[model samples]
Target chain A: MKRILLPLLIVVVPVAATVLWAWWPRTTPPERVSDLYRRYEHNPHLTVAYIEDFPVNDTLTVDVTTIRALDAAGWDTLAKDFRIEPLPDILQKKLNEGKDLVTTFLAPKVNPALSMDTTDLLKNNVVGISQLIHTVSVFSIETESQINAVVNYNLKL
Target chain B: MERKKLKGKELEALLSVAAAEPDGLPGDVAAQATATGMAGFDAWGRRRQRNDLRRRCLAAAVVSLLLCSFASVTAPEAARTSMVVNNGTPRAQVIEGVRQILEHKL
Candidate 1:
């Protein structure tokens, strides 16, 4: 019995470990986000971006081209299904006055303690959001922002 | 047949003849004994070699099978994420929803 069990154990343990390592679901936000980006990076129609900023700055701009593309791509349903916070009062007032708002999305304040390093922000959260947005909607708007630079720099040369 | 008992002199003569013979068995008997012994060794050696080959082949097969299984399981990470993303929201519906938001807001 001992002889039989020893050989069986030697064969079974490594196979089981390899299987678990390969199939285990990724739980971290960073892992999920990176995976999402890799899956969609090959699509020519989609573009992904990431941005990092020091201090909490509440500013977002969405260009007309992007808006039009979102409209054409049929993103209204995604926005409705997902929880999209209303535009800030200032932006709302501008909208009421018929002023074009440039910012497209703004994230709420994050605690400094919870704030990840700039590298982590780019690798995980930023790319994750970009992929999430693209998955929900299709947009052709190109914004001249730091995110564009960061994303382009990260792209394969 | 009637049993015949040898006289003391006859018995002495037979013993002397046996003692005078060489220590080793006759040539034909020795050759036969050596051949039988070697035959047993050769058979055992062949069986051992076959068993070793069989064990090695089984090990290689097990390792290959394990590697293939691991590779197959890991190769679908992207596909797995995509499945999770699109679980409830169909791609077409998401796209349509985005388009509506653009039209209404812009």
Candidate 2:
């Protein structure tokens, strides 16, 4: 009995684990955004990294997207485009709570000519709120060169 | 079939012949060996049992360790705060971003 049981468990454990892994859902978010990004969400040059909460299982979402532009003028338009984003009702309520939630950081580019010192100027936080900080980032690469910046948005259901 | 007291080599040869033949030994000789008992076989059996148990222990330990690692990696993390790292933004999402920007204009 012992001989039969041990070997059976060995074979069954890994197979069961594998089946569980196969059944686990690892869904990728759809990349079907349209129009807001200079209509360049389709452009190979426009790279975006997004992470949001699953509506079915989660409530809080912190979405950070970074985009690049040709110069300060381009930055203005792009930043303006982002600023006009609508606030979800929950986010609006947070803003109404009299809490200053803005925090942004700046990072340097790889090009020596484009490199700039890192400045995380906006680093204020509410100790009781969250550990993850910062919601915006600006990258200043040589005066007229492309600027890569990030803006984070929070959403809740 | 006269009764003959066979010794040593003769006994060995007879047993070898019986082993080589499909008939096994005659029923009377088989019964005699069984009646005498199997003390030597029992000693070897215990040693084999010990080795089997040791092998099982090692295998079980390795399997449990692997299960621990797999569980940790596959387990779902807490959803208290989510900062999903999404790559390759979809067109519809960007359009949503633009919509938000437009709303900000209001």
Candidate 3:
């Protein structure tokens, strides 16, 4: 009985600690797309954007130009916000054309101090235009920059 | 019978008359009836008919292509967007607002 109890405690403690470590929240990340729109309202500069349900049979294409522009900006951090599970034929063309789109989810806060690569890429470019598409449903939506870094690029050296 | 190939100058004269004549038959009156009506005229007629058909088909293809392009440019923007908020914050507050708007419509 003693032997069994000691072994159980040894296994349980480590398992619990591992679980806690895995589950523990590190820092409060930025908001997601939906949150940004809600917090900012429909300010145009910020919004929750997505391409709507696209049909499997219909050949009509629904392109979210916003994602391409955003991809150019480098805000496509999370896989949930950038992946298109099974992309449509036409949308795939745009994606191939260096269009930045995300089907994955990511915290929406832009860390100015972090990296400026995305911002530099999007310099002089527009932002906050969300696509609501419905040509094919196999595709996904991507998040655009709420406050365009291009605007900053225009101002700063 | 041996075939007589017309010279460039003769072909030019023949072509000029053919264009002006409308029927595209040779200018020589003696050859009119016996030149197979117009030297492979059946073949020419078939060619013209095929060309007309091809032109019409090409025009139709162009129109359909234009219409599809227009439709692609004009489709309504649609999405199945939902918001999931965590904890009590503006994010949650806004998601609630959006849900309310959606629910009201439904």
Candidate 4:
């Protein structure tokens, strides 16, 4: 009995663990998203920004004109906040040509630094402004009309 | 001594003897040859059948392997799930949550 049970446990345990890993339900913590919003609320730079035809089917399209209006100073500030380099000359030229800038953020792989829940919510396959912003505030809500967003940066110079 | 080639009479006599013999192989030799031919054909047929079976099984295994690979690649990741807000949860709550997360990250 001992011989039989030992091998059985060894085989069954791994198989069960694999199944659990594959099929487990993953979710985002609501509190994390809420806390982010609360912090934004307390920020002094927050402003109400508008985008025409908002929430156009999972795409976050920022008007190039709006970004250009930021001039050099505002643009530099934005670049610093996002932890990315300043926009290239080619991108600025394109923006001047009346184009929209779209950016998408992907979820991180499972790791200790980034939890599965946070990554999953941030990088859900469904494209939305919320996902791009890494927030849960605008989840599943779409508007046929233009909408306003409370943003921390000036959309116009 | 120098050997003499067959004379015209000698050659004629040999030809007459050969012409008098049967035109086809002897009966027993013909039967044995036919039996050998049939056996060869049978062996060839069996070999061809085995080769065909082996090719079909190899093709099936390759197809099964391809299908398994496709299924594994296309399957959804284990940790990803759809975001569904509870009925009791207000839309404002979700929006606030998203805003906070973005503020921290950005």
The order of the candidates by TM-score, greatest first, is 2, 1, 3, 4
lDDT of 3 by residue, A1-157 (tens): 4434444455455545544444332322234332322432333322233322222122332211122112322233212243324468786787577553322122113421222334443222122212222111112222233222212222333
Q: How do the residues B3-105 of candidate 1 rate in per-residue lDDT, one tens digit apiece?
A: 2333345434433443465255456433433444434434554565567556765775587577758665665432222222222334334333333333333
Q: What is the lDDT of every predicted structure here?
A: 0.37, 0.38, 0.34, 0.35
Q: Report, to 2 decimal places, the DockQ of model 1.
A: 0.05
- Model 1 chain B scores worst on lDDT over the 10 consecutive residues at B78-87
lDDT of 4: 0.35
Q: Model 3: how far is A1 from its true place, Å? A: 93
Candidate 2: tens digits of C-alpha lDDT, residues A1-157 = 7865776677568757764664353432455321222243444433432323322112332232334343445444444534424447776677677543342323333221222344532321110111011122222222221221122223231
| Residues A2-34, model 1: lDDT tens digits | 434545665677666666665653332434333
lDDT of 4 by residue, A48-119 (tens): 121122222234422100111023443343344333344588866865675534432331222212322452
Q: Point out the worst 10-residue segment of candidate 3 chain B by lDDT.
A: B97-106
For model 3, residues B35-103, the per-residue Cα lDDT tens digits are 544455434555665675566655555655555555444433221222222322233333232222222
lDDT of 2 by residue, B1-106 (tens): 3334334455455555545753565675554334443343334445666687778867876876676567656555322212222334443443333223312321
Candidate 1, overall lDDT? 0.37
Number of the predicted model whose DockQ against the real structure is largest: 2
List runs of model 2 lying over 4 Å from the truth. Answer: A1-27, A31-40, A54-77, A83-157, B1-22, B25-33, B36-71, B74-106
Q: After superposition, how far is residue B71 of candidate 3 from its true place, in Å?
A: 0.7
What local lDDT does model 3 show for residue B25?
56
Query: What range of 10 consecutive residues in model 4 chain A has the weakest lDDT sum?
Result: A61-70
Cα displacement (angstroms), candidate 1, residue A90, comes to 24
Q: Which candidate achieves the best lDDT against the true structure?
A: 2
